[model samples]
Target chain A: MGGDNAPSVVLEGVAAALEADPALKIVLCGPDEVVTPFAANHERCEAHVTTQVIDMGEHPARAVRQKKDSSIVVGCRLVKEGQAAGFFSAGSTGACLAAATLVVGRVKGVQRPALAMPLPAPSHPLLLCDVGANADCKPAYLVQFARMAGIYAERILGIPNPRIGLLNIGEEEEKGNDLAIKTHALMAKQVPGFAGNAEGRDILTGDFDVVVCDGFTGNVTLKTIEGTSKVLFKMVKEAMMSSAKAKIGALALKSELYELKDRMSADTYGGAPLLGCKGAVVVGHGSSNAKAVKNGILVTARAARENVSEIIAQTLAGSDASNSEQVE
Target chain B: MGGDNAPSVVLEGVAAALEADPALKIVLCGPDEVVTPFAANHERCEAHVTTQVIDMGEHPARAVRQKKDSSIVVGCRLVKEGQAAGFFSAGSTGACLAAATLVVGRVKGVQRPALAMPLPAPSHPLLLCDVGANADCKPAYLVQFARMAGIYAERILGIPNPRIGLLNIGEEEEKGNDLAIKTHALMAKQVPGFAGNAEGRDILTGDFDVVVCDGFTGNVTLKTIEGTSKVLFKMVKEAMMSSAKAKIGALALKSELYELKDRMSADTYGGAPLLGCKGAVVVGHGSSNAKAVKNGILVTARAARENVSEIIAQTLAGSDASNSEQVE
Candidate 1:
């Protein structure tokens, strides 16, 4: 009812997830026609019919407010009301983010929720936060983003003492504009695992476990990577097919190239979690296939099971306590 | 005597440029030992002995003022005094930018000079401005950057009626922060070929001929492209060589792959120009080879011969006249 493939991909994803985890229960929220038959077939599934659907083109905040009976809104509401442990969407990113923030609510002391996703790197995967959350951000907000992201990286990602780096123009302390300068100074003092500063190049180098920036920059970087990778792969394929000799070489290297491609694929990580929310909320690409949809639900469940939101809340509370004590 | 392989690479570049263009004259600025022998060997070469050197790590503005006898300062002074039509440096970017702004000076009515470089896109190459100058910028300054870069693309890059795009978080005019929103509004009104807003992914897709942004964002974007390309190439090579069959495939595809890599290489463009300056000042990478250095000189000479500085000054004057007329 939401994504490009809609009910078919969604149903397959739910079925796969339930099959993998015997104890898992799914409450599918969509039109009665789409959800009723699927729910009736699966013993562990429950159908919750919705009257409306939010189009991807509609304004996110307005759509969320007006379409209370929309699948996205109802799904998030279930989490808020304790009926569901988490909410997952392969729908509009803005709609999902809006619904998650407005319906599921945010963890207290979090200024804004951010979407954190793993970026493929040389040594290991790096977590990039605020991928498409708050476009305009204050220095204090970035400090909080770093703290929350660090906790998630540590608790959920199983990376103890995750190093946090401020995304900036240069690695030097005095290199960026007012906002970056202020954020760097605050992060150094406030965050325990602050790893100086990370330039854009450093983000994908696996130099730091967590990198934080304003949503605008983070979103731009994410898209740029996606676009570049697409073009690069296309160019490589075209080059390989340009001549018989190249085609032979390409065929020979097919298996190895496939492995590399798999490593860089976003589908491997499922979906980006809308962090700082009280309940786990994950948003996948609109064009997500069955595997991606299944992975999205799995990641969301992992985040919820580990109590990622609670860990972030406790970390923020500790920082607030320290700040108040310093004031006294 | 700048760059990683200074003196040797610089000398070879100068020799190559002279060999290619017999009419071209070079004024080599360095210490006596380095410049004297090189200048003595070439009929079109002149030597200007300098007493000091500016290390890449030195503070740019301070060193430029104190080390007036340094090659960077001396070379820029020649342009300022009308002894040379342009200055090219394969030295520290900060020093080159500082010297260009302080010595060569800015165009009339130009608030700040910017560094403009061509990024290799999927279609044709596109111009990106403010890559490393003016880190923090006002909306008006970005409008100026767009205007100047547009002219550069039309005149130098030979793209008539080049489309100008404001880089932002989203493609929507209303989808950005304070600076982006203001810049988009102004650009839509002011620029004749304004194509509205462009996202980060749009930059590499060859959607716009000239994309303008603040230096901080531009610099980060440039580095990210470089880093991503480097990693992508490595991954492809690794994949291709994973087995004997792949090795044969990689060999067959070698020539085609080289062509693709060449198209994306920064060295193909020679150097980035510090636009809005009174004189042509081109800055190359620190690790520039002999060919890159020669190309940098060739590019600087072309800009000077075309009187790009004069054209920019006149354009700025024209805009000022129109603004005043509207006010009246």
Candidate 2:
């Protein structure tokens, strides 16, 4: 019903996830015809039928409000009604984000929700927040992103006392525009995990566990890396085939190069988690293959099992209480 | 006097450029001691000794104002006084951009000056403008960047009817934040060469000849690519060395890999041009080697020789006149 290859890929992904973990169960929400055949083929699977389909091209918030019977909207409704612990989608990112925020609802005091992904880095993994969530953000929203991502990195990624970095054009506190300058000050004052500013180059160097930015910059940076990596590998392959001697050499090193490329691939991480929603919601790529889809479901399951949202809520409440005490 | 390995690298670069192009002449400006020996050695070289130096960490606009006799200031002053056709520096980018805009001055009617670089793509080169000149920009400024960069690709890169893409979070006219949405509408209506929207991933795909963005996004995008490439190569090398069999394979493909790396290197294009100023200004990496420095000088010479600034002025004037006529 959603994504490039909707029902088939989604069915395969759910089957794979169920097979991998016996403790997992999936509730497939789509049209009766689309979900019934798949549900009949698998045990511990339920088909929650919906009549409406939200096209990717539609405006997210408007569609979410008008099309209450769409797969995305109904799936989020299940989470809100306490029937499902999480929601997974390979559909329109905007629609998923909108449903997660509006239907599943935001945590109390959460200014903005974010989509966080782990970028493969040299030393270790770097978590980048707000990849395509809130494009335009205030200084306070970035600070909240730092707090939420900091908790996620510590609890989920198994990093202790994870250092948070504010992404900016330069490492200097005085550098960057008004938003960066103000956010730098707030994070330093409020966040104990704040290690200072992380420049664009710092993200791949693994200098910080988490880098927080406005969604627009984060989205652009994410796509730029993806585009460059693709073009770079293509260029290498073309150059290798240009000469007879090079082709022979490339054949010998094909396995090693493949391994390197595999390690760099975003599919290694499954999908990005849309954080700050009440329930776990992982959004996979629209062009996600079977492997990526399975991994996305697995990631969502882990987020729900670990009570990540509850921890985030507690952390925010604790910080708020401490601030009020200091004022008193 | 500027850059990380200044004086020596600068002197060696000047020598290399002079040797390559016998018709070219250089006026070396620095401290008397540093420039005297080099000036005496070269046949056509002249030294304009300056006593002051601007440290990389200093505020750019402040340094330009206070340190009038600094090498950066003195060099740009020469361009303003018509003593040099163009200016080249491997110094602090902010200092160079500041001096070029404030000293050499912006082209008449130009809202903002931009730093444009040709990214080596799979098909042809793509020009990304405003890499780090203005951090916060209005929609109008981005429009100007698209126009200036469009003309540059046509005149300098030899691309006819060069396609212009406005960098944003998405390709939709209604997509992106307020600024991007506004800019998209204006570019569609105002810019003749506009090719609609381009996402971050489109920059290296060689889809658009010119991709215009605010300085912050452009700067972050540029550095992200650089960082990713560096880390990627390092990862490949490390993976190759993990086992004896892989090491042997890597050895066979060593030459091919090196060739691939060379092709992706930014050094091929020399340096990025700080466009929209009255004089041609080329800014290179702070850690540039002698080869990169020499190439930077060569790029500056070409821009000056082609009278890039004059053409930009004429084109801008023509557009303004036509726009006013349409309004009437």
Candidate 3:
């Protein structure tokens, strides 16, 4: 009900997750016809029937407020009411973000919730914050995003004292626009483990554990990488098919190429987590397959188990206390 | 002199261009030691000796003003004095941009000059404006950039009535930050052949002949594409080396792969044009080789031959006249 392949792929993903994790429990939220039969056949599964579905093109904020019984909205409500430990969705990104912010709510002292995605880099995944949230951001908001992203990289990703880099056009401190200039000055004093500025080339080089930017730049960079990789791979396939020798070579390299492709695919990470929310909320890609959906649920489950929200809250509170001391 | 492998590579490139075009003439601006020998040997090459050199990392505006004897400054001066029709440099980007704008001057009614680069797309090259000139821009400036880029695409790139797209995170006109939203509204009314908004994926898809954006986002997007391709190709090579089968496959695909790489390389285009200036000025990559320098000169030579600066000035004048009539 929430994704492109709503009921079937979602059900298959849930079934696979349940089989993989014996201790896991799932509450399916969708129309009765979509959820009832699946819940009946699965153990430790319950159906919370939703009456409506939000279309991908609908306005996010308006849809979340008006459609009370929509799957995205109802799922968020379940988290708010303590019925669910975490929520995952592959529906409209805007709808998911809006409902999570409105219903699940933000943690105290967090001015804005940022969308953080773990990009596949050479050595390990690098977390980029504000990927599509808060496109028009203040320098203060960017500093906060850096702090939150650093925490996520540490706790969930298990990288201690994670290095945070400011995403900019140039590596020099004085080389960017007003926002980047102001943010760099603030991050120098405020953010812990603040590495110097990272250029676009540094994004996939695995030089920094986390990078932060206004959502606009981050979003463009993310999509550019996706588009470039897709086009280049297509060209490579065509090149491989150009001659008999190349075709035979491609056959021999088939398994290795598949492995490399799997490493670069978004399905490996499964979903992007909405940071600064009180509840653990992960938003999957709309075109996610059953495998991606399963991985997304597992990531959400891990976030819940590790109490990521609580840890982020405590870290932010500690920073606030330190800031007040410095001001005084 | 200007680039990394200055005196030698620059001389080789000049010699090659001279050999290729029988009527072409070169006015070399560098220290006596670098330019004297080359000019003396070539048939149509002349030396205009300059004493100072601007370092790549020097402050742009300050360096241009102080280093009047530098090659970049002297080159622009040559254009201003009508001694040369165009100027080409592979030196400091900022210094080249500052010198071109301050010395060669701007077209009438042009607020700011922009850097336009032709990106190699699947079908044909697409023009992207403000690649690294104006970092922070107003909506009106972006509209002007679109107009300037459109002219460059049509006049030089040979695309007739080139479709222009406003680069943004989403295709919808209403989607984006303040600058994007405001620019989209203005472009729809102002820009001719306005094809609508283009997402990041659209940049490489060749859906639009030209795309306009603030320098910051454009720079980031450009570098991200470069970085992603490099890292992915490295990974592919490693995958091909994992076993004997992959090694044979790699050999078979070697020639085809090299052709694809050549098509995607920046050296193919040679240089980016600095549009809206009173003279044809092209800035080559800092790491440009002899071949790239030769092409950069060719591009500048063609721009000068076509009187691109005059055409752009006339186009702006015409657009301004039409806008005033609409207002009346």
Candidate 4:
């Protein structure tokens, strides 16, 4: 409901999901008037789907309180009551965050759930933590973020004991500010499965499984990488199109270029999961059209099947295991 | 002489510099015995081209001290006595920074000199400050960095007023961490000449005249941008060479691709300058070749001819327009 096309795009995503998966079920959350026409067209919409409409212009948090019928509020309630396996939202991130925390709640001992945004690599994507969820973070919080991200990688991305790297300046462990310095020490000692220090260039090298930083640096780093990729891609395209000779070369390379774009382009990565939340909520670019929204829904659905929350719980136990081992 | 190629590449750069500009004079420092042969044949090479070459295998800081005749130490000495205008090295960054500070001294009132690296931009190259100089930065240090970078832009890059932006997660004046938030307030009120807040995405927009951040974030941002450009270049080249059908198109587009490479290449700008020092010192890539070394020489020469140090002094003058206004 928060996307570029909002209800229409979301409805299309729902239709595409059901058609492709056959056994898929969705709880369409939006204004009844807004969603009825789209839902009416699908044959099994009424049987497999449940519609709890919310107002279009309503402030998501406040509306969640007053309107018991509001989609987002109802969706959270469904998860709380175990009527739904997991809640997914294309609604307001602020609204989603607030509702998820107040309604669904954080995992046991998890300081705060982080927004882990996956950066697409040539093969497997690199996951960065605290992207939008936690703005100001402590060293302790960053340590927890690494645990959560590491578990997510193991369960979702299928890597074992994923090497967690603290995003820092220099290769030297002593480099960076008080936060980075302390965080590095904490991850090295506390986070049992963590890799040592990782320089910024190490992200693309895929040396570390999960890269952790405070949201302030993490968000900036993520956006910087994103903005840089876009600018670089545009500049490269401009270069390829600069002269008659380059244009001919570009045409010859069109097929291979398309595959490369498909491989590296951020759009193909589906959506970024707000990981520490109780339910799997993947935030697609709010400007998502039909295809992007479709992919985002699928990502959340697959995450639910993977039991991401339980895997994170199990990894935290590994830290406890090493702690007890040292005590002996 | 501190580069990956050491004395050989450093020697080639000196030779190239001599060949290009007759007005360009060189004082080759390193093992004088090694450089003697090149100086004999090279036209610009003469008795005036003094050599105080330091030991190559020694530790950077210790090496600077034990042999006062070391290239880094001797070259810096030339700048100290006003025999030469600036120093250029593709050697150890640590050695260069140490030699410049201990030998060349810093501009009056300058706390820490920042290395402002120029990045390839569509319109003009960007100057990202504190790339490796001051890793853990304070608000005051960042403020000073903005001033130093401003001076470089105004004098060397010919950017007047030089709109400054503090790199952050978002463009909000209150968006960043403790350091960034404080710096933003100070920048808005203290440095009124600035362009206000800029996000990571804004770095390559060619919108602002200068961008400033702590070394941690700044270095990370720079490396990420560089990595993205490199990966894209490889991807494009691979696509262009993938197939015969595409090869025909590739053949037609050869000129445009060449122009693209020219526009995106980093060497065209030569080396990064360590700003706020009393004398000129350029730090090129450690892996730099002869042409890169020659360009570094020309860059320092231009800075010398343009009276960069004097302009910086004027730029920092509290009695002058900028600081007087800041004082008010």
Candidate 5:
């Protein structure tokens, strides 16, 4: 009810997720007409009819507060009330983030919750935190983001002692804006696996496990990569069509090219996790297909099973204590 | 004297530029051994011997102030003294920027000088302003950057009424950090050919002729595009070599692929102009080859011929008058 292709794609994705995992139970929250039939057809499924839907264009915080019976809000409420272990939405990113923060709440000691997306590097996946959460951030906020992202990398991605890099314009500590300079100084002393500063080129080079920045820079960097890939692929296709020999070559390599595209696509990772939240909140892309929705649910399930939120809470609390001790 | 392959590559590039444009004159500035022989051989070339050389890793402003005899410093001095109309360097970016700003000076009404880079979009090249100059900028400075960039696009790129966009995380005027929000308001009221806010994805979409941002975001965006292209092309190459059929296909499309690469390469654009400076100052890439250096000189010559600095000064003076009137 929140995404571009809501109801149909969402229902199809739920069905696929159910088929993939026999023990997984889903509680659909949408209009009765949208959820009732789907829930009745599937085993271990229940319908929690929602009266309202949050549109993609609506202001996130206002919509979450005004639309009490909205699917995004109700889904987050379900997580807070212990009815659901996790919430996955392929709807409005802002609405999902707002609902998760307001209803599901944040872990204690967390100043700001961050959105962490796994970038599909050629060698391995790299997690970029605060993709579009807190745009204007303090150095302390970035340090916390690094800590939470490191926890997520270890618990879910199975990366032991993950190296965390500070996303900056240059590799040197003295080479960025005010925020980056301050954050680099703090992260050096506070973070466990601090790998110094990573330039924009290092994001997808598989040099660091997690990269942290203010939401603005991270968001711009993420979209730039997406835009560049689309433009280059279009150029590649046009080049292939320019000649008969090239067209034949394109035909022979069609399947492999598609496989490469899938590997680089956002659909492969399915969704980005909202780290520092009390519940597992995975926000899927608004233009998500059925397969993407399915993968997003699986990621949510894994986070819930691993109790990632608890680990983040404990780790942050311990770090805060140590920081205060160092001050004393 | 300057750049990674100094003396040899720089001399070769000078020769190529002179050959291409018979009316052009070049003044070689470096050590006697490096510049004398080259200048002696060329018809319109003169040698200006400088003793010291600024290393790439040296602090920008500090090094520029200290290294009076260095190639970058001496070149900018030539521009200041009217011995040369422009300066082109494939040396340290920071050193070049510092020298140009400090020696050649700034336009009368300009608040801060900006580095404007031409991004090679598929449709036409788009100019991105403040690529890596002022990291933290005021709204007024951004307005000036937009004005300067728009002029550069119209004069050099030969576009009429070149559209300008304010780079932000989102398209909405309200959807950004403190700097973006304030800049968007100022640009809408002041900037000529303002096309509203452009998201990160809009940078390459050819929707806008010129995009303005603070240097930090602009730098991150620029490098992210470069990084993404490299990683994706490597993936494409790997995909091509995965099978015999694909290998044959790659062979058929080799020339077309290399052409596409050249079109997207930094060498094609040659150099980024340091706008708002008193003289035409072009900073070539550190890894620039002979061809890139030749193109850089051509770009510098074009900027000088167009009297870009004088135009920028007049435009800014008019804008400043209007702004003061509005205040009154």
Candidate 6:
């Protein structure tokens, strides 16, 4: 509802999605007066006039009630009442997160939710979880993340035996703190199909399909990698602009340079899924534009059709060996 | 020295170092036969024949005694005895770290030694500490790392008021657990000019001059950044080579691309220093060639001239700041 550029970018995204899939359904969740004008210009959004506006400025969980007819509240209600499969937001992340947790709640046996995103590596993109969904974590939560991420990888990525690794300070089973040590033991014994300890570097190295970590470490690692990439690209840009020779050289290399830039764009990575939820919801980038939103919709649609949540439940409910294999 | 391309790379680095600096001196500490022959090839090496050959296969710390005659051990002895300003190794990190603590010893008030590296960024380089120095840590150790890293940024890079930051999982001052929270408190109380708490992305964002963390978290952050960069570079190369036009385009951009690669070279920032030691020490890349080795020596010489160790000690000695900034 209120991401970067807000209604304009989001409205364009909705249009793009409708163009690609004529039969696709959508329920916009934001201020009616603001969004109605954008929708009024669109011919495809016929007969779907539902007004429930959620203010981007409000604290999502608490102020959500204040805007009783807000878009987010309505969107969330649609999902809760079976009118929609899931909710998508490019608005206040806190609001989206609060809504996702409070509205849909957790699946049975899932203690905390994880935010999983595919790292755009040269190798097959690896899934790193707990980006910011949960701050404090227990060993059991990490183990469940491994199991959950593994199933998603197998179904979504089609990677056979999707190896699940617990992100730690080291590769040695006994090397990390009490949390890592306990998680390692549990992964080795209780969690079937565990791939053992994977260090931070291994996250993007693609040594494992899923890198499971507590929210604290996971969010830090994710941000570090992103920051590093930006700084490096900036360096390249500065170097290219430094001198006449370099500038001339950059002119000649602009295509290849941009080709590299496009590969690292956050938009290319569609969305960060709120994993282990009953519904199929995906969170697009806060700075998302038309293309990214379109991709987010498609991703969510696929997850819904694929019944990812159902698979997660069945996987967690199955036998030790079956669950273990399913975990990958 | 168990890093990628261990002995061979280490050998090339030594060769490079000896050739570059006329005032430079070295005390080789690996296997005498392995390091001596190469040492002999360089002209004016008549005064550089000292050697202590340590077994590569032996436990790094324990091997120090068995191969008391090894290069690492002997080199460490020289530093311990004040004959050399620093020890450089591209060999066993465990052995190097062990010998650094056991032989040279730590400065007063410094709990653990840290391996600090300067990662290439868009705006100047960023200094990250405790890359892989110690596994576990006390909040006190993190406090010490900030002081030591601050001194390093000052004398080496000449960045006055170097912004020292604690690499936490989150930017919120109150977000982390006992370790992060306690560390935050001490840093706020003790550090000279500290930047509250920085997230993982801040490192590459060039937001701070010195990024500090415990060995476990720091090591993970360091490696993950490296891996992500590697993967990203590879992706650019692959995209450039995917098609005929792209390949042709890449050829036009080859010079600029090479410039980018050179600017991003890990060794360009010199070597990772073993901070909080009695003397200056640098660890070149295990696979380093002549230039990296030479650069390491120059880095060590600069640190020695700047009295980096003494400044770090003084910083620790006057940690409460009641004594004010110590002048060594």
Query: Per-residue alpha-carbon lDDT of model 5 for A13-85, expressed as tens digits?
Result: 9899999999899989999998998899999889999999899888999999999999999999999999999
What is candidate 5's CA lDDT for residue A312?
91
Candidate 2 residue B315 Cα shift, in angstroms, is: 2.0
lDDT (tens digit, per residue) of candidate 5 on B1-328 = 6789987899999999999888889888999998998888898899999999999899989999999999999999999999999999999999999999899999898989999999999888999999999888888889889999999999987889999999888878789988888888888899889999887788898999999998988998888888899999999999999999889889998999999999998887789999999989999989889999999999999999999999999998877765663310
The per-model lDDT (C-alpha) reads 0.87, 0.86, 0.89, 0.74, 0.91, 0.74
**In angstroms, how far off is A79's CA in candidate 5?**
0.8
Candidate 4 per-residue C-alpha lDDT over B1-328 given as tens digits, one digit per residue, 9 for 90 to 100: 5677876777777877877888887766555566667677776664333345444344556767776766778788889999888888887776787788888988886667888888877778788887877777777677878887887888787778888889886666756777888888767765546887778788888887789988778877887777667667777677777777877776776666667667766677678888888778888877777777888888888888877777666666663443333311
List model 6 lDDT by residue over B134-213, tens digit each: 76677877888888888898889778889999888666677675678888877887888799888987786767999988
Model 4 ranges with Cα > 4 A deviation: A43-83, A90-95, A317-328, B43-69, B319-328
Docking quality of model 6: it rates as acceptable
Question: Which of the numbered candidates is closest to the native, going by highest TM-score?
Answer: 5
Per-residue lDDT, model 3, residue A23, is 84
Ranking by TM-score: 5, 3, 1, 2, 4, 6
How far does residue B46 in candidate 3 sit from its true spot (Å)?
A: 1.3
TM value for model 2: 0.95
Q: What is the per-residue lDDT of model 3 for residues A54-137, given as tens digits with 9 covering 90 to 100?
A: 999999999999999999999999999999999999999999999999999998878789999998887899998888987899
Model 2, B1-328: lDDT tens digits are 7679998888899999999888888889899999988989997788999999998999999999999999999999999999999999988888999999889999997878999988877678799988989888888788888888887788777889999999998878898977788888778877878998899889988789999998888999999888878887887778778777767766767787888887777877778898899988999888877888898888788889889999889888888853442310
The residue-level lDDT of candidate 1 at A136 comes to 80
Top-down DockQ ranking = 5, 3, 1, 2, 4, 6
- Our model 2 lands, by Cα RMSD against the true structure, at 2.7
Best by lDDT: 5
lDDT of 6 by residue, A165-205 (tens): 88886667766766778878877866656888888767877
Candidate 1 wrong stretches, greater than 4 Å? A324-328, B321-328
Going through the candidates in order, their DockQ values are 0.76, 0.66, 0.80, 0.53, 0.80, 0.46
lDDT measured at residue B227 in model 3 versus the true structure, 0 to 100: 88
